[model samples]
Target: MMQINSNPILAFLVTLIFISIPLSALAAKHNNATEKLSLNQDDIHGLWIEKRKKKLAVWIEDCGNALCGRIYWMKKPLDKKGQPKLDPHNPDTKLRNRPRCGMKILSGFVKNKENHWQEGKIYNPNNGSTYSSKIELSKSGILKVRGFIGLSLFGKTLKWERPEQKLQHCG
Candidate 1:
């Protein structure tokens, strides 16, 4: 057997290589993970109906921190009696007070687990109630949204389907 001298330089090089390999791999894996959640503007654009409400349209978009959703359109502006008024004792006035055409009903949604997103709020225009909300994207392009009083078990779930694209006419 031949005697081999262990050099500090070789040991340092080996340690550096080992650390770099895993670091680079981790970076690549992170990139791939983010790519999987790549959401396009069109994917969330258009009208979305609130399952609880008969005819309400909430539009989803990308907020500064995470994804945001708002009420961009509605079937009617006034109540059945044709009066433009808001409920005085409503708890979700911040969301439902504005005109239906431009209301931010959802905000601060962060991706959770795999297909679900948490840390968001959903506001109900009917009763003016805002609750903690979670959103899940299904394979069929349907968004399952849950808004609860305290926990998810105590609230209601709404499923909104992606609406058909419409042509914009500017006259």
Candidate 2:
């Protein structure tokens, strides 16, 4: 006669369920940190220095219903051939030859709260990828820009600061 013993498997499954409950709760808490902030057009406007490189700057402007940002300046504006650097990494062949400067890297960001812009996309010219994005102005005047692929939890946050020296354009 053969007998079945399910006690060990049942105990293990129960342990997994208990462990997952806490893990799920932790994930929810982490996502809440990405919630909207209190911000306005004026706070987000002007040139901002990319955290990764201070020499690179983005000009943020008000575009009727939404806000947009473009690559306004770069430490090395020109290549060895004395020509403006181009978006060589762009996925679109037609756009690949376009100048990196003045290219709008940020788009479709609409104000979601008094301090947060949501439903936006941020383009990384280097990698030629665009991700879902949001923007928030911190109390210290730093812009907290978050870009994600699937969920806000699975994204990165970059701090952008207003340039001390203003550029000629951003209107």
Candidate 3:
């Protein structure tokens, strides 16, 4: 006759179940954090203005590999003459060619760290140039946007305020 220790089997089962519970909870918490950090199209669907002067509506949609932002609406469409205008002094010709509306101004923002995004690109309409950009969302609902040329030492930072409207159209 073979004698088996039932205590060992029961103890193993309890240990396994106990270990799985916390592991599953940890996994769920991790997944929730990832979901929160993800930049969804609806999360950025609003009008964001630069210094409360130049109003530009930003639409957060996917670009092929990552996420991108497009200018869907603008406050000023044309100059005094109402002609198809151009940003002549813009440093980047690519950005200069972009019209007031439907211009892709931001791209490639990957989630990094906690509530901080890096590895992004931002286009400046004033200079018509693209620079390495980074965006961070503060607890106060302020977006800190920084754009640099060569290195982080040489860059400009801009704080954009979130707009109120859900949908905005160019006038």
Q: Give me the candidate number with maximum lDDT.
A: 2
Q: Write the residue-wise lDDT of candidate 2 on 1-171 in tens digits.
A: 422345777777788999999999998877653322222224688778876577678888987799999988888788899898888888898999988889999999999887789999999988889999999987766889999998999999998876655554422
Per-residue lDDT over 1-171 for candidate 1, one digit per residue giving the tens place of the 0 to 100 score = 422236777777778999999999999988965544343212554456655554666777788878887665555656677765344436645534545446677988888776678999976656667799998877766778889878789987888864444422111
Residue-wise C-alpha lDDT for candidate 3, range 53-119, written one tens digit per residue: 6556666666777668877767776768885445665765565554567777789988776657789
Determine the backbone clash count of candidate 3: 3
Better of 1 and 2 by lDDT: 2
Q: Rank the candidates by TM-score, best first.
A: 2, 3, 1
For TM-score, candidate 2 versus 3, the one ahead is: 2
| Candidate number with greatest TM-score | 2
Scored by lDDT, model 3 comes in at 0.69
Runs with alpha carbons beyond 4 Å of true place in candidate 3:
1-47, 84-98
Q: Model 1: number of clashes?
A: 0
Question: What's each prediction's TM-score?
Answer: 0.60, 0.70, 0.62
